[model samples]
Target: MIDTERQDWARGWSKLKGFVEREGHARVPYEHKEGAFPLGQWVAEQRRAYGAGQMNGRRAARLEKLGMAWSAADARFQENLAAARVYYQEHWTLCAPRSAGALDKPVGQWLSNLRRPGALDGHPEWEAALEAIDEDWNPSWPAEWQRHYAVVREILAEESILAYVEPGVTVHGMDIGKWLARQRQSEVWAALADGQRERLEAVGVVPHVQALEEPAGAEEPAEPSTAPVSAFDRGVAAPGAVQGPARAL
Candidate 1:
């Protein structure tokens, strides 16, 4: 009976060794198995034994040498976090669209998932890391709004804010003029949170409306163009239009 147990242990160890060599981590899911062998169940049993001080010293040492991840959630979160830091470094914000990703990780979708209420309830460290990366990573407003705001702010840095950004103007493919027009409308401006309005104002945005005489496009990406004009250029070039700051973002 004892010899049979030894053979069983050896078989499980061999499988785990192969798994670690291939996957680089001993994080097999609980429901995972190999043919008839309950490898994941065996791994969990080993962990439980170690925690309860019932595992043999040699066996525990071997598992430790394999770099077993005691807390799968922590290990996974850390990996995703590394990707997120890289993303933030490049984009300067974590308000990524649902489809956005970085470092081969679906960090944008990951962040969006966390934005759901109670997603990070017990993970204060994750929350803190996100906040450190971008204090407003998760704002009260729609993340899409925050993303567009970021684009407009970037444009403002290059030139003065325009009084009337026309429909044709585009920046990074975003219809800056159309978005601004909606923001400038009476009802829309009033609906904005005070903090949101303050941030927009800081970037030189003010309540605005396109003149009735001009035709425009809808809320969509600015059409592609060579030597494309900017929101600043469009509004500045428009006849007698005067608003926005002289300083750039």
Candidate 2:
């Protein structure tokens, strides 16, 4: 049994859809059609035509009601968009780094873990932070961060350990370089060949270890400089060098 309100809404919606289709405009949600029509003016025109006897009162009322429905839908859509913008602004840091396609699966799993009961007890900020990220939007991180993310993602993907790259598990403080270095030295890193290690070090993923040994049969490293060390060099004294009142004694 079709209620009168449902019947009326269907009739009006059909007309609107037909009009949009006939005009060659792609059918889209009411919110997406904001610029497609001047809905208020169209409703006014229908009312004016009805007053002039160009259309009967029933048809005019139906069209007018349809226009109002579209207006309401559009208003709600706009409110949602504004709210999303605020969410992104507040949580951009968290969302941007995990925006890559490779990170999507782990990110989803991470969010699901966070939403579990009592998971966020002591960390209330995480509730808001996780809510701000929309998996559908896939908001991109800054250009610099994106580059770093890509490098780390590639390394993880190649190693078949993408799970380790999940938020908070690794990448704490967003320090991908440090994380990569630590991972490189882990037991898992033994699976990688020398070439892979060298490649990672080349890109600064792993810190370059200064070779302390002289080349085979080559002279020893130069003697430590006698010039006064800058404040920055205080603790990094030269090997075999003495300092302080011990030298005076």
Candidate 3:
């Protein structure tokens, strides 16, 4: 069942967002709040933050300033947040159609998508980093994982997330999720001719390699140990094992 809350929020956002474009404005309801953001203030703030010259630091500072200015009255912020959430969702749909149901995928399924043939065949280093990304960032996605995966793969393989142009890095507007998704897929790696594959693998996405090499003192990967355990064997007279719940006390 679709979550009613999300449905309502999305519907409300669609209505409100119509007034958020370059030449759009929605008047605040008098009863809603007297201190709501005025159109002019909102535009100026957006201009400062979204302008070509703004960096993350400056953009964040501006946002914090705006947040502080609106701190005294939170209704406006809440409204904007709700609207923003919907806006982000819509943008994802357009830019990353594969993430249609990203909020609902099972973690395992999403992880497994990383292993599909030709998906992450190339860029082994990037693939490993993505597979090893902090669990906190692992999406607790749902069945729509495919859609998000498609979006991510596209961005990583084509658009890239780095905003600055450099010899070994691609700069684009794609987000982490999309970029990671690309790492899982075999875009660059899969497309290589056999002769080029080994060379690419040895090179292995220069940016990712540099990142992994940053910890100069990190230990080399240890040889894996092999251990065996059996549920039945462990259940029988194992030291400190429970003895039938202490024989029912």
Candidate 4:
């Protein structure tokens, strides 16, 4: 009976997978370039739509409403990226996965090196990547081939199944773009309310939890805006309640 149930479950999963793939693939934009990361592609489309005036009032309104949530998510990503840099700086040794044996020129090493100050700033690859940036801030990468470059290379080393490599040992560039996008998306998600959280989660959005916190500043938050008004009323305004703006107009 258990075997039968298991088989049925398997069949159901297969059917579900088929349905999702069909629907998802169909919705995919045909304009997808040969070598574009998924997030990069999405970002490009967003930029194009925004630039070409295709986003329209409705889209702008929605984005503005969502902007605060998005900003929070962005802050989180910045924090994560900062944490990752700290981790790499302290534990550069574990940057490469165990599978990368005998290859003295592993991708992890290259990526770690790139993390060093100014290492990638002048690199030909970096320059090429930057040059391909469209007015919408989309960079053109080879669509068919995956890159196992730098940080992506490290991710590949850590999880082979999580990444794909191509001719130049490039980790799937799409994954890299997606990683960056998630970091950005987290910024949006952080400021959202419960309903927004549910919506994002329904779409499989997951943010990277910050493993550490930065030191807190000694400065306190500014006093509330109404403070001065209240103080002035008590100290001087009560005697001449009708003053300033009231007297002016």
How many angstroms is residue 212 displaced in model 1 relative to the true structure, after the best TM-score fit?
16
- Candidate 2 TM-score, true structure as reference: 0.24
TM-score of 4: 0.17
1-249 in candidate 2: lDDT tens per residue? Answer: 759955744554565656565654322322232345543234334444555677655665665543333233334333333334443444342333333222123442343344456866865433443444443232222234333444464554455332233223323245553444454455645655564455444443442234466568867676765977432134223443222321100
Residue 134, candidate 1: C-alpha displacement in angstroms: 1.2
- Whole-model lDDT for model 4 versus the true structure? 0.35
Clashes of each: 4, 0, 15, 17
TM-score-superior candidate, 2 or 3:
2
lDDT of each: 0.74, 0.42, 0.36, 0.35
Which prediction has more favorable TM-score, 1 or 2? 1
lDDT string, candidate 3, 99-186, tens digits: 2333343323334454456755654533443433322122333324324333333443453332221222221233433333243345
Count residue pairs with overlapping backbones in model 3.
15
Worst 10 residues of 3 by lDDT: 162-171
Candidate No. with top TM-score:
1
Native-vs-model 2 lDDT?
A: 0.42
